[model samples]
Target: MPSTEITDDTFIRRYADDIAYVAQQPPATDLATLAAQLDTVAPRYEAAGITGHEDLETASLHLDEALRATGTDRDAFLRRAHNLLRPLVADMTQEYRLAAGD
Candidate 1:
C-alpha cells in the first residue's frame, strides 16, 4: 500500500510487512489464533462500528485482553495488528485504483 497525506509511506509498508509476518507466524500459543479467536474481539467492533485505522490500536488492545483470557499471550499483539492491516490493504488498494481512474 502507498502512503497518504495522513501517514508516511514507510509506515504503510511496515504495516504490510507486519501483517504478512503475523499471518505466517507459528502460533505456539492460542493467543495468536486470530481467526478462531476473533469471535470474542468482534463485539468490541460491533459496539464501536469498526470505522477506520484510528481504531486499530484500540481494537488490538481489546483483542489482546480477549487472547489473554483464552490462556495465551504470545501472538495477541501481532494478530491484532494483522487484523488491522487487512482492511488497510483493501482501502489503500481501492484508493490506488481510483487514482488510476478505474
Candidate 2:
C-alpha cells in the first residue's frame, strides 16, 4: 500500500511521543531515531510549504554527522540535537494549533 502524503499535522502526530521523550530525556538511540525521522520528513516539510525547511535540513545533517562520530561525547551530541530540534518542534506545534483553530 502506498503511504499517504506527509503533512505538518501528520508529521507532528508521528513524532509527538518521540519529541516528548527527547525533550525530557534523550538517549543516543532516541536521538538517532529522531535524526532519521527528521531526515525522512525534511523534503515533505519543504513540499508542504513549511518555513524553516532549510534549517531542518541543516540540523538533520548535523545530526547525521553527530551519529557517525563514535568517539564524540554522547551528552554533547544530545544537547546539540535537542537545541536544534526544540525550536523546530515548537514552530510546527504552533502551526498545527493555529491551523486547527485551537
Candidate 3:
C-alpha cells in the first residue's frame, strides 16, 4: 500500500483538529464517522494489521509536528488529537470485525 500522504500544512492541521475533537467525546457515532473517513486515506493500515494504538502513535508524531509548526491552541490541539485518534480506533474495530467475519 502507498504511504499516507498527509503532508500539506492545511491537511495536517485539519487532521490534527479532527484527532483532537474525537478525543474529548465518549465513544459514539462520531467516532464511527471519523473511522469511515480515515478508511479513505489509509485503509492499508487496517488491512496490514495495524491497530488503533499503532495509528495513534503514528498520528501523534504528525500532530506533534503540526502543533510545533502552527503553535496550535491547547484546547484545539487536544480536540484535534482526539478526532485523529477516533478514526484509528474505529478502523481497528472494523478490522477486527471483518477478520472475524462479521
Candidate 4:
C-alpha cells in the first residue's frame, strides 16, 4: 500500500525557520511586531503536533515581556527568547534531515 502519511509540509518546520530569523534580528528591531508575528503562529502549532516540551509559547511570552521591559530587563527577556528559540531551530533542522533520509 502507498504511504498514507500526510506529507503536508509541517508548520513546525516553517516555525523553526521563522523563529530562527526572528532571533537573529538586531536589538533595535521592534519587539511588538515580532510578538504579533509569533501570536499568529500559536494557533497552528497545536494542530501541527508541536508538543508541550517545545515551549514555543514561552518564547512568545518573553517577547511580550521584552516589549514592556527596559534597559537590562528588556535585554534579559530578549536573551531568554533567543536562547529558547535557537535550539528549536537546530532540533527541527535535525528532524527534517532525518525524515528526509527516511
Per-residue lDDT of model 2, residues 10-54, tens digit only: 434545554443233342244466566666556655665667666
Considering TM-score, where higher is better, how would the candidates rank from best to worst? Answer: 4, 2, 3, 1
- Number of clashing residue pairs in every model? 0, 0, 20, 0
Taking all chains together, each candidate's TM-score versus the true structure is: 0.29, 0.52, 0.30, 0.55
Every candidate's lDDT: 0.42, 0.54, 0.46, 0.53
C-alpha RMSD values across all candidates: 14.0, 12.5, 10.5, 13.9
Q: Model 1 has how many clashing residue pairs? A: 0
Error of 2 at 72 (Å): 5.6
Model 3 C-alpha lDDT per residue in residues 1-102, reported as the tens digit of each score: 853333234343445343333333322233333333443434444455655655565555544544455434533554555566646655555555566566
Q: How high a TM-score does candidate 2 get? A: 0.52
Residue pairs of candidate 2 with colliding backbone atoms? none
Model 4, stretches more than 4 Å misplaced?
A: 1-29, 52-54, 90-102
**Model 1, C-alpha of 98: deviation from truth (Å):** 2.8
Query: Over 4 Å off in model 3, which ranges?
Result: 1-48, 51-54, 58-72, 100-102
Q: Which candidate is the best by lDDT?
A: 2
Candidate closer to the true structure by TM-score (higher is better), 3 or 4 = 4
